[model samples]
Target: MKNLLNSVVGHQAVIDRLTSLVTTNRLPNTLILSGAKSIGKYKTALGLGQNIFCKSKVGASACGVCGSCLRVKNEQHESLQILKSNDGLIKVDQAREVTHFLSKQNNVGEYKVVIIDGAEYMNSQSANALLKTLEEPPENCFIILVSSSLYKLLPTIRSRAQIFRFGSLTTGQLKQIKPVDDWLIELSGANLEIMEKLQDSSNQEIYMKLASSVSQLSESNYDACVKQITSFTKNKQHSLVLIQALQSLIHASYKKSLGMSMQKIDWQEPALERLSALTQSQIMELFTESVKFEYYQKSNFDILLIFESLFLKLISYFNGEAHHASMDRYSYTP
Candidate 1:
């Protein structure tokens, strides 16, 4: 626990609360680990899980060197179950699968732990089904619901759990982190996804390239936009990384709209304005569709057609011709 706290910068209060919960024998049955996505909620939950199952530190803390701790650390623990996602949602059947393992007493452990990384995406049926288990969870089971937006979850499901909000790095604290420029650039874009990955130094070059691509994308050059994004696609190993980059762009633009500072970086005003005009919800709708376009590229969707659609959408928004653009009622409605 001390190691986890010391590793993640800032969020001291959250660390304290989690440490208190684990070390004091006051852990909640259903914990809502609420915070922005990629802000360490899942990682924290896993840390808590490790501490829970660590055999050496038997009483209330984890002994980092124990066999149990090693297993959990390597994600080989039998009792530790993580439901990644199913059918674009954590559906009822998936939740049912959890019940199967949860039904059995921990085979060789004291506790059975489950962490739902994106609980908000659990559809209504699955959520309600999970609520039953949460309402009367097994004696030694721990349920951690990690959410980026708790509001997207049902109040009934929420009421069944103890909601703990995740804390973010203040600008001052973030400025102190290593690779300050890179981290700040990500935070400025309000992208939790890339921020976490940036901590992994190996991805630094790719992260910076993606940042440059996002900053440089505009309608002035459709071919350039395609080349940049396509190049980004070629370079990125995971499709989710690209989506996360776009998500960060959305967040940073929103914060910029609210006048948040980027600390010492000389953030170009025109660049931000151009980014805002190009994305900012109006462009987000199109950009989001672009992901599906990228996804379908493997199965009949033309890459040019997809990027072209995005180019036109960005041009309309950039030229203040969005009102005249033929967007669906739902596209720019929000």
Candidate 2:
């Protein structure tokens, strides 16, 4: 338990609560671990399972060296089952198979633990199949549903499970774990996993490219902005990275406009400063539109028009013109 708690960055309150529940032998059979992506809900579930299955526990903690502990650590435990979506949804057949798996007695371990990784991806048909099992969960069996969005889950399934909400770390809390840049942390919305990954990844080239595009926008070079974005959208993966880079710049500038010191690298500060020309609300609108365009891009929207529309919106905002681009509906094209 001590090691497990230490491995996770933040959310000590949830850990303490789960620890207490385990010690009291009153942990819920079905638990909904709901929180933002990369916020440690899945890790918490794994830790809780490890502690519970550890045969030689010492004072409300896992021994870490026991056979059960080793299996859980290596994810080789027979009693532990992990369910994930295929393509985009967890089909009804998969949910039914899990129900069948739970029906059997646990011969290898004392408890049967099932973790639905993207619980929200369970469509209505699959959710109903799983709901039957939740209604009458087998003894010594545990179900941990992990989701970033809880509202997507069926109400009946949620009602039977004890929901535990996880939260992101604050700036001060994040600093305790690693020396992550404050701006990067804000960009990740305080998700430590995402912040660390972004830090380690080689995004410098794309960041520089994105910076140049922003410079063009600052110069009121609408044609250049369109050309740059059009070239970027050619590679879907690169285009997504550009959108993220834009979001980071917008966020940094928004913070600076509110009297906060800019958190990005020194070179990027100039472009961010130029973006500070717009009010906080206008900056927010632009960021929101960029996010929408990214989503539309994923759904196979017309790439040329999407980037062109985005460039036009940014040009209008910078020129002090209120351009209302109707995002009420997206026109899909192959």
Candidate 3:
């Protein structure tokens, strides 16, 4: 089936806004779609781009059977160019190439659309190189900058684009679009994009390992948590995955303590029930710590040391051994 405008889940308001822009022919040349990772910004941008280029649009929607729409759907459209980092960061040369492409005319479609996925991956040099193009974009050409990290984007580049923030999908929305794995939905906190990745059977095992690690923490088995982290996670990215799993566990527990409904994960619910003894403030504190842990991971700090310290802190909290004194002294800085 074609991934048309309606194929994208949730974000009805974003869809509505895009419909208005397209119908009124007021679509901006530079647009920044921002939101949490795997929350559908990139998909929405791609779908919208197709709809804009489709020769036969049906009242703000694209006619999927049309040749133009089919080509765009299959990523064979000559007028559509997508730029994304292949090696972790969008290099300056990529930006320069996109700038050159945008300066030219539309090849086959009515609009030339350029999608820069992970726009935040643009380093200082790349961002600066793209600034001029954003400032004076070519006619009938639209540039979409998709990013989960809004703060990382250069302010000058952000200022030149019309920004749209895509929010997380609600439980109801998640159920409608992706319902095969409800537990994954709960664990992801309705981040359907991430849930989609977790849908792979292989990923489920990693999540189980992570859940086991959290369960170990509740039992005050600090060594088990460390071993699990080391065993399943090989590097900083892997450590971040473990951290996300832990964050999900903590968040689920927090919701449970508040009498909020949550889908029960067989592996995680046991520890979450035990962790109910944790106060709201303590849960919030750990949530904050997870944020810092992510920052430290991104900063290229020592991976083993970071996970070890985090597991140790989790042990302290679960054992009622954590204190303000220790919280103040805890540092993951390299």
Candidate 4:
């Protein structure tokens, strides 16, 4: 039988475990699929939904061509509810909607499945609003919380669910899913979302330019880095891609400094070599700032100011000046 679960790229162990639970009808009411971003946790949730609602299941998997399977594939299924974040948050109103959704009868299938992608985006109020549902879910209802940041979820919510951790896909597995250039795959850190972003020619161009600027960065040329990055940061999505790309470079450089062999990409080697010169502590500082910059970007901070500030600190690192700027000024509760 052509199984829908077979379509998911990696995480075979998770698939097998889920298949057993579904086949035995012992699947939990609440599940937490925790992992790094873009490693296909949501896809696994969808595959599980398909198997649960599959009308023509041969064994423990969906037929992938039945009416129920197609609807789920198209995200048009009546029983499968997928909630994604808006403006980087799943607010209380969305939580109320989920409660309302599960409250109603399961008219279309044996179960009502709610998959919240980026589950950590749920604020305290929203998480509290959904706690009752999590604690006492209606019979035949399944809620799958998909998150890259498991620590951010409320303990009560985590306590009520079965947690499954996912890891990054391997190069071979990534290639099987999408046969892109090897450098592109490495740049994505085996993450599907970043790989997709790098597929665009324009994004590739921006990545090269950014990589070159950062690789050659010095105290005197730091302003050039700001100009290059700010030009693309005007688009929020582009800014995110740029930040992730920078982080990838930093990670690769740190590994190289530790005597790890990285696949040598012509365009990126110069930057990697440049970054590898920093001490381990310096590398960590850059990484820490990058993470904070990413958080601010997602939280709707002033993009231009943050980008400029980030470059200023970058220059200080090269100039041998201690980075003393307080990040609390840009911090928000979210």
Number of the top candidate by TM-score? 3
Q: Compose the digit string of candidate 1's lDDT tens values, residues 244-316.
A: 5445555556667667754333333444566665445664565466456445544544444444455556556
Which candidate do you rate higher for lDDT, 2 or 4?
4
Instruction: Quote each prediction's TM-score.
Output: 0.60, 0.82, 0.83, 0.77
Give the top-scoring candidate (lDDT). Answer: 4
Residue 160, model 4, lDDT = 99
Q: lDDT by residue for model 3 over 253-298, one digit each (tens)?
A: 8899899877877787767866776789988987887778777777
Give the Å shift of residue 153 in candidate 1: 1.1
Off by over 4 Å in 3: 1-3, 105-110, 175-179, 200-225, 302-334
Candidate 1 weakest ten by summed lDDT: 325-334
| Model 3 weakest lDDT span, ten residues long | 322-331
Better of 1 and 2 by TM-score: 2
lDDT for each of the candidates?
0.66, 0.76, 0.78, 0.83
Q: How high is the lDDT of residue 158 in model 3?
A: 88
- Local accuracy of candidate 4 as per-residue lDDT tens digits, 1-334: 3555787788999889988999998999999999987677888888888999997887777898888888887788999888999999999999999999999976555688999999999999999999999999999999999999999999999999999988778999888878888888778777877889888988887778778887768767877777877777788888887888778878888888889766778998888767665689988877787788688787877766765666666566666767656743533324
Residue-level lDDT of model 2, residues 172-213, one tens digit each, is: 867876787776776665666557656745554566666666
Better of 1 and 2 by lDDT: 2
